[model samples]
Target: MGILVQEDKGLFHLQSAGMSYILQLVNDYPAHVYWGKKLRSGSNLEGLLNLGGNRGLDRLPQEYPQYGTGDFRTPAYQVRLEDGTRITELKYSGYRVVEGKPSLPGLPSVYVESAQEAQTLELTLKDDYAKLSVILRYTVFEHTNVITRSVEFTNAGETQLRLQRALSASVDFSSGDMDMIYLAGAWSREGNLTRRRLVQGGTTIGSRRGMSSHQLNPFAALVKPETDENHGEAYGFSLVYSGGFEAEAEVDSFGMTRFTMGLNSFDFAWLLEPGEQFQTPEVVMVYSSEGIGEMSRTYHRLYRTRLCRGLYRDKERPILVNNWEATYFNFDADKLESIAAEGAKLGIELFVLDDGWFGKRDADNSSLGDWVEDLRKLPGGLSDVAQRVNNLGLQFGLWFEPEMISPDSELYRKHPDWCLHVPGRRRSEARWQLVLDYTREDVRQYIYESLSRIFSTVPISYVKWDMNRCLTEIGSAELPSERQGETAHRYVLGLYELLERITSEFPHILFESCCSGGGRFDPGMLHYMPQTWTSDDTDAVERLKIQYGTSLVYPVSSIGAHVSAVPNHQVGRITPLSFRGDVAMSGNFGYELDLTKFTDEEKELVKEQVANYKQIRSLVQQGNLYRLQSPFEGNETAWMFVSDDQREALVYYFRVMAVPHPPRRSLKLNGLNPELDYILEASGEVYGGDRLMQAGLALPDIQQDFVSGCYKLKVQE
Candidate 1:
């Protein structure tokens, strides 16, 4: 039995007829160094290899040998030459059915196929890279939460095979509503399609984009990993692709990327030679309760009993507050204490004192490694404040830009040779900081030991791991020039190892990855931390637009959105608190403002939001996420998500520009059980199902009165 399924440790598990293969999916902030684990990161795939029952590998698995494809994983198809060489490939037929038929042959068509409980596809990797012959597999409904006892294992050499190949799949959707994750480099969108400019630091590398059927909204695009990594060794070390919002189509205006034809991604490709076999990447389907629906969660609690870990405590997470936005680089312990005290009053579950708490960090310009408490900044010592915050009925968290160092710091001071710089050429520096050479065994050990030591002393429940700068002048001081080019790849491996060590040690601690704002936020990084900070700009108005872009791919629970101040700290925009809260409520809701300065009215508003979060959190976080209006494209945006039972629904509507007494604004509400009679609670309005949607609602002269409204609807059985 050859099978690949999503597992608990942020990856899909791969198995063969009689051999083993390890599959790990990681979200890397390519700009920042990769985080912990005994992982090896290839171009398109990364993470520790599960060579034995429970032991992890030092690098990502290159090829799965159990299968005949020779590559890590291919599709259901395979090929063999007259000379007995197997060729795992599929030539795209070029077109697909528009309403419900197959392609007309050269029209360039794509889509994924999935039933109620499973999704599967195939591919041919004969172009771009070298030696072919492969097979890929994906179980549609089984996604990211099964391991052996649920985890996938690695198979060294299981057959007399000869060939190399690649395979992968992405649930192709956009990340418009996601927070802290930014494509800040270069980006553009056309129709329901958008492309992110893939830049290393400040330079452009390549861009990846997707286009789907005009009328059919699938959750994602599943294609074969057919990219040529330029070297032409028949190697495709990496690729990250996606599918769609299978649970909630209405979250993004009901326009979904449902599924695609193939599982085309990075890890799917691999190399197999003499005495080797092959394995395919796993596939898993995800179902939730809050925004999309709950049928999947309640039904599949034991998704991967063999390979998956973590107790099934599907309860509400703690309400945490982060200080990254409140005080970027200028806050002492007293200042921190003030912030933490206010958080306690609001009943926030955790208090995270972000950057500047370590080293000689007075300005945004220096000292990364001085992990010890800054006595100069906090005369009371950090432990004292942690105790106080604990006394205030809140858990504590701290921030660290551990992967970086500054020219004005002690770590860099002691080892100028430790920075990743070219021998005689000047290196690029951001925020007056340089990245630490984690490739060195000594540097990796120091950072890991320091963090472990600090965590042992503090009762910190979370760690806001922020990487503010991207890599520049990439090269290592220790590695030979031959593998110097491997520096970028090696840096990522180092990062994964560090994070692996941290998380394994502090299994209870919550970790966050932030690169300035959302730059490093991706599925590659999500493996370590469950969620990411969506972005740094907190203006509600701007956020509505920004979040629209983020929500395309990510789920609401994964976005780090917060309610900040007016004349927003980033761009000066004073939006109403109500608007801010309504938008922020769309994601992992939190606040990044100085709570002490909030007026009593604002405080009351905060209390209300907290309550609202409690009431509808299950619906928002777990339900199928939908997008009703294009916050970016439409004049007025509206979208709603309904639970499977159809008893309750949450609809968010925003009027971007009010029309001057327009004749009539037609609103077509989707996701409704059209036959059932329903009532809109806010207006005390009752109308037949079709008319309420087709005839639409007459929005008042909203420019002066209502900007946005969340309507709750109840359906009569």
Candidate 2:
């Protein structure tokens, strides 16, 4: 259970029963080539702080050249351990270059980058040795979840070194069974308004391959750079930054997987002459039972369970209907109030005024962060509309993109340098807009102050925090030379910190993340928001694919779905109102369509659907889910749910295509109390469970239907 020591390498960890892991570390790495620590670990790890195991290296000098810090205080190397229950690792972050220490040419003779220096003061420098690149002490808590690893690279000596940064980790994936050979791909893209991409199966969906690495299990790494000649090599997604760095991420991996995250983009060498400070990219791996969606859900749980226990978990989510797909940058406040009045009549929760509320946001090209109410459209201040809705028994919600500014807006004119732009370099204008850098505390403060004023003044129940673009041409002319690449990493961290502060101060207001639909749909955002808009696509048919893919990991409660009108604004496909209600039932359900346009009967249907949702919210939100047939399988897909008590179950079978002829009997169900009598109440039609569930029983089967009417099963004890 403990580490043993030797003279050369500081420590050797021994595996023990139920021990879960063996991590050997040599704290002082003589050199500073950060990208390839794994290949260099066995030779460079030289510092010593062993837990209980023997030091594997030949004993070296206390201030030996072998055990020393490099130019930047980045994490040296790492070993990851995980079971279904727990994931843990030992790693280090902060490293400062000290003067007069052991120097390596222009590098420091000896350096110190301890876990304590990084402000993770809770960690103990349990073990270290001279092995690979500089290996050393780290906290066991770092790898406990989806957080990967973080290394702070401080310029210790007086001279700046070439910053060719690439961050990676090593994992011993000794699986008890055959390792699930998964093809590594990234749905990730930088936040640049000018660029957008999707990569699946290690190949970019529409363009050339983005960054991804090929793993040889705990060993070789074949990097598929953006400039790689071979376009089809199966590899893990790797993003290389040849310039200034910035960005924060929570990584997750399976079997011998290293969720390597880093910020590159630093084309020029950092000019850290002396007394200059900087930090390497931070990588944290979060754990989730499912995949990407759960990866995001875990972040939310961490915020709730770990960080903000005092913060009440918001139970009453805002029931705001968006006007994006309903009216799409059209309609005035009077028109909005008419719709809000109708929503209030249905016990509809909140009335939200979506986009087109601000300056020239009409066609998605301008008015991103122009918070002023569009007088041309609204004819009245936004608060007038909010007050009107509040009086009508509905809470009001507003949309804002404070992190972005359009060229057509007043904010961009005053502070043109506020964005992440470099002088003389062409900047990307995604959707004809740019992301305002929040890396600067001033920018962060501006957003905080502006939104706080609006929210505090009004009875706003929710705010849709939307990020419509990704980063391209990332460079902050505001930062110093050594810390320039820091914009990306720092920007992301700044965002997290900003959200933390804002949410902490205003705990009652709900924030829903809207990243150009679902682009920012990850654990990172969930840490700040109660729910995310499932996708920008309000089309019910497209939503099925988007929501189905989203649900593989995330709880249905975290997904935000709406019943929008068809010729679905995104994908022109009109579906039944009943079907829309059924699909939206799984998540935080609401409707986005203009209710004023619906008939009296349809309004009554909305009322009925709302009531039905409340009755089964417990079942749909907190039940064991099973996919009897995959949506990707065939013309029809079936899914079932059983409550924790095992008494009630609901099955949904949808046939996308009509069958020429249908069978007379329904398919037999499973996971029921086999010996108990049952009853089926489907669409208010009741049938005895024992008779309906009997094998070969002749029962009425609706010829393959897409209407997700429930087939309820109640089992008697």
Candidate 3:
């Protein structure tokens, strides 16, 4: 649970709750020794650095390898000197141990409330010829098997240096016999878990699309082939970054695997003047001996409590109903109020007026940067509608895409150079809008002032911050020629600054981030906004896989799930209302349909669904999740949440499509106190915890497609 420095043997051991990460300086080069199950202090760790004689740098497990060196795999960093050479070697200089984690300047990272929560090790390496000093930072949590790594580069030389590649962290594993698992999908179908065997070559997953594109997530995991939900070893690496990122696993001919992750070096170069420093975003690493589930739970707890901040960090999220899918751009004040009225009757706690509320935005092409309300739609502006919804006993929320500007908008017309584009280059647009040049302080200031005016005037309780497009031209108007490659990373940094200002100024507002749904759903955004619209695809069947795969890394509390109208807006799949409610309840419950159109029977069912979710919302949000079955495997999907005390449990089971003459099945639960007796609320049957976990409970024999069931278990009194 602390960092140990064995200077005599040049070994540094960082031990967390269930794992140990040991590294050593061999011949003045830091080399990875071991990272796995915990090892006792004073053990013979030196023998673990078993690099054989003929110690070629290529075969050594380096803590941070460099290019042009004998290693020659993927360098953690690369710098071009003033002499125009890309060759440099760094040697271990000094190191220090700190009591608490230090925040990365101008970046979002996992934070600590107290000094006792974690310990950080700062190891310094110096390329004396280039006068560049690299400080590698590693922090280990005292209570979780989580280690975060980041790197800081300082230009100590008299002349400027161009950094061609400066990745955050890298690790080398002795064995490449593992399976690579990553989340891959696009748009409505985000977070599809994909796995493959690690081959004897470079395997990479990343986003060159500016925002952490929905095409791929900034995460990857390596696991033993036998690893499943509950057993075997797994190592997870997730970048706390939102922009372009590259994660690679290179298996060398020697069977060693080198895993690296950081800002994508593609079209990226930072010019560091003398005495200037550049800090890379942190990469969170988790290790588990009890398989992928334990690794996920470790990340879940750490991220939920530490990474995400503000008023909503520990509070229960409101049951919100957003009007996007219900009315789109056709809604006026009257229509919005009517929707809010019906939502209030159904016990919805918040009403979100998503997109198309401002500046002639009847469609996505216009009025993106203009924050003023359209007089034609709302005669009295946002105040009128916010108050109207508030009168209906619902908290009011508004949507804004502050990072984009439409060509037809006043902001863009006044300052055409404000968007990301190279001079004389044709600007490309997506979703009928161009990405704002967030690298400029003036642009960020204007956006801040615009939103601040509304927040000050309106009674807004929530904000759905959306970015509908990715960076295309990848050039900032204000950056110099040498720094043009820095635009993509600078845009992300500027966005973080704006987000920090807005969220800090309005701490009471619950901020939910969206990038046309799950496109920018990464840890960096979660630091300012507590939750994210998991995906725009609200179809219960599609969400079964989306939410299940997302739960592998994100906590349930940070997932924004909603029950939309059927024929679901995205997929047009007509599913039962009850089934929709069952699936959406597993996350922060919400509705995304026109409630006024519901039938009388459907209204009653909606009321019951709301009530049921209210009774178990706390358990679902904060409880430990145990996945029993995966939708990826077959027709059935099952998962459950167990309270910390193990006295209360809520189980959800879904049958996507009914099978003809199916064999009887029972769900065996996990994370239960095996010695206790429990009462199943659904059937009024009492059973022993051991029996429920071992023998299992019989699933209902319903012969209907898209059918679902929810059960509550309470310890018998």
Candidate 4:
């Protein structure tokens, strides 16, 4: 069933894949009744409400929790009027069902390639008191257990409407027992999975750092108290936004749970003039009755195919070698060519030159805005180096922090007003660089053209778009004083516009977004760029947790994992070369090291890693992943990936720190056909799929810290 509307009972039931969501109108107000397994047709709605021995205001599920309904729970969506009023009420007005999904203007959203691929439900709720209207839009894909939700506000009344808090979607559950799972960390240690019980009262996670921040990601999962990778019910919400966002999970006094998500309310105020409308970003909702594993796979399939678009979306990315930790800012043409020559000999496909390419920029403190090449470093110019790398049989890639400007740069010297700064206040600087006020048309055009000029000079195949700092003096000269609150949101809009124009123009270029490495790794950025640098910490042991935590929601194809030199650049924890290579292979494999200095043995190992990865790139990038053992629970972590057709599988096992006479732990594999027989590539041993999954494969003995093993299993024909 797609979307069924019962006009007689004033109910809307949406069914997609194997799940169903039910919404009904009670006294003209929209209320959510059931959102779980597919229900039988003509099921009694009253029985699903679970009113707790009451049938009035206290028990009704408030779809848009309002102050006038005696629902003390936080209102789902909020706004204010120019007449100084925040007391608002919304009642269901009308709704319509459409064929295909509609794109959010100037925003990154999932698109339906065909009318038969998806169906949409647009429900209109009008606030008669403020003469404002709210459109609740939901799109259900025919073949995916995913329902995308967004809100649109239109000023239909006589006066201007100011929106202080307009959340995208909200759902209420009569049960209070659930566990909240989220990813939280800082800088190089991003995407650390954290789980806690959803107790009484409210728990909110968000980012006010302007660029989704490094502190918290814009996704959260609520599951049954006993939920795990293999069992129990789970509900996940991921906001399709790159900028600041807010997710609130609150439990009311009656032990009911409510989850709401949207743009962060802090420094966010939108003024909607009469006859104008504003659309909030989309929040993807997924339900899984089997467990969190099924929920994650649904997200992976939806985002990898629908959300991430471009030349690299379905194609396997070329193995790259980046010169960041290798030379930092102290590399010249000769030095870069030496590294590229070694990489080419080792089968690396791309070479990326990072930073210090232009304008007296030997360090991070200067030349951020100067896109021109420094003759002293390049001798002839960047074109010479690009051509040289091309002759070495490697595609050339370059890094640019185009959103920032140094105070001593030529561009900043000419246009001091271009940076974001409050009129009379001192501008705060991070990394000795100031953020550009992208809200200004002049600033956006200048930066866009500057980048275009660089791409025109060389046959660059990739660009690492990096933003090294956050917004400090968050003010824009283009916006008036009264509308300064709109700067943050408008800045995000400007960024999207710039990205859209550039990505569309240079469709051949492979763009990888890195905000201090994984800071801005959200769905919105993935919508423009296919992959993001997972993190800056290349330590093999640390990456075990980072990659595992990131894989909770994001697919392996969208993560940028690299093998860096040791003693590790970030943590000083040097491990075995093979261990590092194994961890990096879990994502878009690459190397971040000075290959020219590698020992003969290490060079051979690098070549072997590259060769091995190519043989199984598609299996790792486009396979069904199963998280076997959690690193959060023990010293050992294990994961496996089965090819889509179930003909092959790869299993990875890692031991962070070895213990004396440790207990043996068996990893039960998932996503395999029990009736098939499989052969071990390394051992020439054959076993039935059912035996491999039920009896399980025992881990090899762990002899040292930071050690790992990889197993390849093939179905016996």
TM-score of each: 0.64, 0.67, 0.99, 0.98
Best by TM-score: 3
Summarize candidate 2's per-residue lDDT along 1-717 as a digit string, tens digits: 222223344333221211112233345322111221112224433332222454222221121121123211122222111111111122332232222112122110011233321112111221122111222222222222322233333334433333344342322211212112112222221111111121211211111111111101011122222312122111222111111222211111211112223443334233333344334433333333233322333333333333222232435344466766667787888888888888888878787788788776778877666676778887767778888988898888888877787887788888888788888988789788887887788888888887888877878878888776776666776787556755665566677668878877887778887766655554445546757776666665555555655554345556788898866766577787888877777667888878988989899999888877777766665565554444544565555667656688877655555566665636555445555565565544444445444561233455544555557677644
lDDT tens digits by residue: candidate 4, 88-128:
88888999999989999988998888888889999999988
**Candidate 3 per-residue lDDT over residues 374-472, each given as its tens digit:** 999999899999999999999999999999999989999999999999889898988889999999999999999999999999999999999888789
Q: Count the backbone clashes (under 3 Å) in each candidate.
A: 168, 92, 0, 0
Q: Candidate 4, which segments miss by more than 4 Å at Cα?
A: 50-58, 663-665
Q: Could you give the candidate ranking by TM-score, starting with the highest?
A: 3, 4, 2, 1
Model 1: per-residue Cα lDDT over 28-139, one tens digit each: 1000012111122233323333234421211213222223433222122332332565543222211111221121111111122323222232222221122333333333
Instruction: Please give the CA lDDT of all the candidate structures.
Output: 0.50, 0.50, 0.93, 0.89
* Candidates in descending lDDT order: 3, 4, 1, 2
Candidate 2 has an lDDT of 0.50
For model 3, give the 10-residue run with minimal summed lDDT.
Answer: 49-58
Stretches of candidate 1 off by over 4 Å are 1-314, 663-666, 675-701, 715-717
Instruction: Superpose all Cα atoms of candidate 2 onto the true structure and report the RMSD in Å to 1 decimal.
Output: 11.6
**On a 0 to 100 scale, what is the lDDT of residue 585 in model 1?**
81
Clashes of 3: 0
